[model samples]
Target: MNDVSFLPHARLDDLIQLLLTQGFRVIGPRVRAGVIAYDTIDAATQLPWGWRDAQAPGRYRLEQTAGSRCFAWANGAQAIKPFLFAPREPLWQARRAAGCFEVQELVPPPRPLAFLGVRACDLAALAIHDRHFLGGLHPDPYYAARGEEMLLIAVNCTHPADTCFCAATGDGPQAAAGFDLALTELDDGFVAQAGSQEGRELMQALVLAPATPEQRAAASQAIGLAAAAQTRRLPAPERLRRLYQRLDHSRWEDVGARCLSCGNCTQVCPTCFCHREQDVPALEGEATVHERQWDSCFSAGHAWLHGYQVRPEIRQRYRQWLTHKLAGWQAQFGRSGCVGCGRCISWCPVGIDLTEEVEVLLAEAADGA
Candidate 1:
């Protein structure tokens, strides 16, 4: 741990201004369409000041807080994934020529961004994405280019949403690493600590005072209480493999029936990265545009093969998503796909909870064994 400093709550916007002065686009939590989501901001006044959110399975509502706290909400439907791996991007375009077609790969717009109010679970998800995209056998040039230079200013979650379970997964309430700067908001101000050279330089520019021992203790206490407050948890890590044994179990059919196959879970999932490519040809047959768009397992065409679909049933689709997220992902990626953010639970229109489904399967597998 590095030396900590005190950033007064009233001057929190100073950090935003500082980032902007350094030629960085600042993106922070803001209220839009009645929910808190990360959006671009030019000044601190745009942040969701004095706002908090209430979330549950298939439900979400926003309310005003009593004080002028900037980040009372735990999370919203959006995460930092959208910034790194965008929803829609043009891959390449082809134009007809005399005897051949000319193809060119499209480059993403260049912009260095600073993310604000990011939580620990979201940080964990970003790490998983980094491993999958940057550390893979074939590195993704698109992700590598966009994710390379951004600054991550993370916030240690002091308020855990009811649906949150990052503590159980050992991923959240407080971020231990993978951030340039981490913040713990207290009543009077924020206890800010730098994790990288950039963070240190930024803090020095702000000319903040060193945090007193008492303030540090208060920050620690705030994080501890947030961890203790989490009510949801995944099953034991060793027991997660049991999910594979119960693929044929009846629980999948039950959940599938209620699932609308709307793909809301994947949309809101912080770690999900499924996508498909499309080609748009010109009416004159002179040019064709190739674009990549986000896709989900719940979609009917996701499993299409050579004139056939692999998963034709909704139960099978649901099972594929669950099995991959909890069990198969570990085998393929050396880590669990889920970070326990609980966005999937809250955003699902039918209120499907992966944690509850895992419990049922584990119990059934235990009885059968």
Candidate 2:
């Protein structure tokens, strides 16, 4: 941990302006359509300054929020996987003119990026995905390039939705790692801290001033306040794992009766990294290209193969997804894939709260016994 640089309240925008001067396309959240979503911005005017969101099972909506609400918005429908893995992308191009087939490996887009206003839960999710994609049997070249060549500016959550469960897992409202820089919006200014080398460089280049002892204390207290304000909390991690092992089809069916397999839960989830692939013909008369797109297990075709779908039954798919997220992920990556960002809960059109679901399962299991 390097000595973090800080600046007076007035020099805040200068930090963003500084990143732009360095040729990085900085992205943060702003009000768009009916909600706040991440996008490119040049100044504070474009961000969701005093706004926040209301999320629940099968629902998500933004409300004119109060306070120094830089992260007033809770969770967005989109996550980092789409940008890192791309919903759909060509893997390679090929041509079979007369007899022999020719192929060319795809080179992904070169976009040096810096993500701002990111929450700690999202950071945890990214770490889980990184473990699967980069530390697994096969590494994705395209995802690796984007992930490896970017900066993370995490924001400690000042507001959490009713669905957030990160605190239950000891992940955060405050980020202790994986960020180049972390920012906490203050009433009079912002509190910035450097957790990595790149973060130190960012602060130095921006020429921000050193944080006062007061600012540091405020930042720490603010983070604790946010966590204490959470509305949802998961059971013990060991209990969560046992809950999965005790799954029963009848109870799952009752839950599945409400789940439309619309995939909003998985879609908004920051760590759900499953995806499908495809191939397309090039504009020229002689070539074809391979593609990779984001996939969700809840989708009907996700389990499909040559003749039959692997987990054709909806009940099976639902159970598999829940089990993998809460249990198998720990074994596979030594971390729970869920970061408790609550995107799944808030974004679901029908408001299917996962915490409630887990509790229901536990209750039913106990009653059955």
Candidate 3:
């Protein structure tokens, strides 16, 4: 069956209403805390309308635009990670009851969610999470339960951010799959196409018209321009084979000197899933609550094992993060951990670019060899 449809810009409200009526807790891009972020939305007014952001290394500022575009800006700091793998969650609780301890696991209630304005790189990150949490040797029950109820509505990027390098990673400028519906925003409306059965059913409620050749061509041209516009590119992946060989490389010290070890990069990274579990006892010390919170290798406590800290130096911690993200992850996951969304670049307090570091490190390694 034909999967393409055209929805005029004014009719976006209908789409939101349809999702709400279908019992999906809809979340979309909204302006909050001076930036665009995914949040619960009940109407079209809650979206980041006519808002654009200027982004650079360690910089972000939102500004009003004259256009009617709903998603002209590049991504914000937040991604879909928080929605699936929560930052902090209660796993189970143990209480003193019936002259003994009673333990009950607290699984989050499954709520169907529809994510709007999801970008291609973000979508790729979600797929990578699926591989780890769902396709791993033993699937995580919590992630699996929450992930299955999600509906993804991807938006094709027309304006690429200066820091964006999804094209170099072959992850974006356009979403290829794993979405219920994909939209390419044009001047007047969106060229929408279904990627799943549910998406087709949702489009029927919008009463969308058949897309014209002009609209389809405009969509293709917009993404093409975005792809060609990217300037940031990672160092050759093949060169990273010498990454472990350069363990004692002096570059680690250079990056470590400026690195604050703030753990912001891992927090913003959509695919970094390191977490630590804790048990908190009540004031009476009779009851305890088991919780899991996101953890990062940048933290000093991350290397704590038994009575010894394996990686006590900040340089060692930073090296572990970069090497794992760019190289070691390939050995474990059969794919690189980075999706090239550039959040690590933009969110760094010191504005350190991993792309630059990798390039320099690889070049030095080649020269030394």
How accurate locally, in lDDT, is each candidate? 0.88, 0.77, 0.89
Collision count for each candidate, in order: 0, 11, 0
In candidate 3, position 335 carries an lDDT of 68
Error of 2 at 73 (Å): 2.4
- 1 or 3, greater by lDDT: 3
lDDT, candidate 1, 36-96, per-residue tens: 9899998878987788888888988899877667877789998989988989988889998
Off by over 4 Å in 1: none
lDDT of 2 by residue, 51-108 (tens): 7788766677777756665666667877566777677878888888679887888868
Would you list the clashing residue pairs of candidate 1? Answer: none
Q: Write the per-residue lDDT of candidate 3 for residues 25-115, one digit (tens) a residue.
A: 9999999999888999999888887888787888878899888899998899889889999999889999999899999988888999999
What TM-score, to 2 decimals, does candidate 1 have? 0.97
Model 3 residue runs over 4 Å out of place are 365-369
The whole-model C-alpha lDDT of candidate 1 against the native structure comes to 0.88
TM-score of each: 0.97, 0.92, 0.97
Model 2: residue 297 alpha-carbon error in angstroms = 0.6
